[model samples]
Target chain A: MPTLRRDFESRDDLIAHYREQFPEAAAVSDWVSDTRGGRDAAEALLDNVDPVEYGRTRNHLSGAVTRLSPYLRHGVLGLAETRDAALAKVDDPSRAYKLVNELAWRDYYRRVLAEIGDAVWDDREPYKTGLDAEDYADDMPDDVTNAETGNDFVDGSVRELYETGYLHNQQRMKLAAYVVHWRRVRWQAGAAWFLSHLLDGDVASNNLSWQWVASTFSHQPYIFNQENLRQWMGGRFTGDSVGGGSPFRGEYDEIKARIFPRA
Target chain B: MNENARDKAVIWVHDEMLSLSWLGYVRRAAERTEIVGAVFVFDDTWVADERLSLKRLVFMAECLEQMPGVEVRRGDVVQEVSAFAEAHGTTRIVSLASTSPRLRRQGEQLGVDWVCEPPFVELPARIDLKRFSRYWGKAKSRVFRTTEEIMEQA
Candidate 1:
């Protein structure tokens, strides 16, 4: 029942105060996210949201995602109010349709979590991949955890998560795919790793989305090839050969065939 | 109706409802009653168990700073809420509703009252939740309605 100090001269002071208070966490990762929290910050980001451009480029890493997840996750911005903000921005309601639809995904996931409770950590259904859950390894590979994976995209994405405590949705999905499929690790291990790092990490969205990629909560598994990776990387990373050959380099048919050999 | 009754309540501001609007909702639900305390507890055990990074705590702290009425504490939620209420001589505890099982458990332990936030969208009572598309089928029209239109329907 200890009270936290309410006084701080600046953000540095605030970080310093928390570091002293939570030394174990500071020891784990001293990195602090630039994404500030609170209503002022949330409203500022909300004011700049361009729903039209968001629809066009949101799939790409450089897209205008509104970066409102941390706020939304913490409930600093009401979901309904945010949707209304988007609607108010455009004359025709359809222009804001994509953003609104995406927000609904959040609501949908939360409803599932509410119903299932602790089962959010459980596999919602059997793996759609021909492989059994037993086929996946229980431990996260050291290479992936250490961000020492030879794959440029994989390593870059992991490092981005550690350094920023945030990832573009593309980065998140790509890295999740690599962990669950490429390394053949169970999705739970990968989800736990993300929970430790992501600013917006929550049981509902994080675990279910991982299950979506692992094919345990969706119709099929998610996989991407070199071209798809490069397109979304937005030039921040290379899809070029790593160590003289790229693992992601191939057509979806070839990739799927390799990834799901038993299928 | 009396001032003594008005001062007998506390608000448990859990992690999910850190917004100003949530606070406003709690206040309105109190019906002009003077809430003696607004408390947010940092579940250190849960954080350590999850191995959450320091950045997450910092982000939460930042959020708390923006919340004008919340008293920040580090400990078990139930104990902190109880200690806070005892200190302020409050017997009634209230909070905005959340889907988090942990929060719900703690809320029940503290005998907290829940006020539901305004809905993001209204759906049929038995809508399919197995897939996003299925839920969207039932949620889209209601979500797409303008606020004015939604209010008018209400």
Candidate 2:
């Protein structure tokens, strides 16, 4: 079949054209329709670097995180170029160490993919949790995808991901944990779901990070409690603002007992 | 680099690497080989994959708009690239080296000239690839050096 070629007057036009041209991809939302491309935008993002603040508050939802992954993933900006950009902005390159380390993690995952190849799609090691790899569900639950997980924090993150094609790093970790540990879904399923929606998604980074959360690549499976969400997110999703009491509201021990009753 | 022969070469710019780094190769290649034109092929297999979202396609389209004379075609990679090169009467095809298995396989199938760009950080050929810390330690000196130092050395 011939590839469709046409000019988009605006981003909405491009999105409309894509939806009409490829109806099969309709299940995946075009929420991130305004993503700018090209070298200039990438450079502008790089130029506005705050490596010092990024180190201190990158974990928070309102952190000084550099939203440069989509550009980096697409190779509009190379890792070396981003590193040099960071170094140029700072008086000392060490100030940019946290940011550089994050970038290196991306490179590390790529190298891992290069070495392991198709194995990345499989469990790198057996699950560390009590659960068996085969025991986990191969598909993500529709409730989770529909942002009706009943947990405000998780649902909010899912909504953000669908709307913006981006999520805070900490939010991703929590969501991945919720999928693997709480919902008893396989990390591969979650990874695939994420890859379909994420603008910055790559097979290597996304899958490996999911594997890490699933404890197939890490020492322990990551799990979170209600207090952790409240502390970081405050009343943004949980509390009186949403009127839906936090599903995650519980003590750590209670959460552990509830999610891992067998243990 | 045969100056006269280069005038007839074809440059294939993949969507994965759209930065000036790839452009540098195109410009340098154009200097030595015949610059038939640059081509970006949107592989049908990828388009058909549900995982390939509209955002990525739009992003690629925007990138392509910046490059002059970059023909955007849709078809099987090998056939489209080969037909384009053949149409231009040039067997020579140039592309940036990529770590993606798919891209590497495509390169082999196309029998194109691959150009290796300098990595962000260079690691030893046989280093343990299991962990980032190990790889980062070996590459620290090279990666952490100031741009001015690199430029001065160059």
Candidate 3:
């Protein structure tokens, strides 16, 4: 029922819009802007996202355009009104369907939140065991923090996370697989990072999606190989590439050399 | 049974906002039924635990805390309703007819006169009739959807 639309391309732009729109209202509160670590998170994730390729990328381009989740979550915008506005703009049913699916997934996760409770946080036993112990032997907790383990992908991603507080969805999967399987750190740790940084973060979606990638809950855990990573990177894997050539480039012994030298 | 001394009303909400919606219903029903206000009940376990986020919990708490004219009781659905009914000394229960089978069964098992209130209320007579008529038309259009069906022989 209330029409409130504020548009800006940068943080300074956003600030300008806020000041212009709510001159009488108090300056935007820290609770509204900073607490979630919004600006830093967005910059981190957006770092690796090439501006030219950003609009062309498949995963989150639509999510980027609307960028209404935070507003919806905070009740600053109404869901039905937003849906009506989107449908009115786009004539393509398929695009509309895609947007609708994202929205529906929002509702689905909410329902799952109501039903599943703590079970959502539990680890996937089969995948935990199914993986070769060697696959995880070198997984260090610091892989998340150190980031500079000779893997440009991991380093760039961590930097992206530190800078933007967001990541391309595809990159999120790649990073999750890298840490969970390739590096073999726990998924919960990675999910916590996502929750801490992502401004658009919803606990149910972030946690459950992480668990899904971790192969903890699904019938089969998703252990992505180097080839899949290459495909997502648009087949771009130099030493400068995120994971450094094939995730399987070096054998189990070689990965140990690169990531876990002391072992 | 006597019509004048219904004594109490139970608002059967099938969803989250049912508390607010039922409160409105009780106000309208007061004109027709001899009753006090209403009681709101929820099945704590039936709701998804993940959805009870800190933000949502805070929001629901605010709603329940601020509600002025009605009493709110929360617990396992049947237990709360039965307990409230005994404590308040009322038999007449008012509930929204939830499309959910579980809720409908619960209502049936309660074995009391339950009024199944509609979710939406028609506009009161005092508002502009033309605006209300337009709203009524648009509401019907929004809800109606086309789907294929096969006629069956009885």
Q: Which candidate tops DockQ?
A: 1
| lDDT, residue A224, model 3 | 45
RMSD of each: 1.8, 3.0, 14.6
Full-model lDDT, candidate 1: 0.86
- Candidate 1 lDDT over residue span A59-129, tens digit each: 98889889999888889988888999999999988999899998999999999988999999889898887
lDDT (tens digit, per residue) of candidate 3 on A145-262: 5576667667777666554445667677777767776666777767765554444455566776777776665554555445445566643333244543455454445654554444
lDDT of each candidate versus the true structure: 0.86, 0.76, 0.47
Best by lDDT: 1
Clash tally, candidates in order? 0, 6, 23
**Which stretches of candidate 3 lie above 4 Å from their native place?**
A1-57, A60-81, A132-140, A225-227, A234-263, B1-154
Docking class of 1: medium
Query: How close is chain B to the truth by TM-score, in each candidate?
Result: 0.89, 0.84, 0.55
For candidate 2, write residues A97-146 as lDDT tens digits: 88988988888888888788778889998887777877899899999999
Q: Supply the TM-score for candidate 1.
A: 0.96
Candidate maximizing TM-score = 1
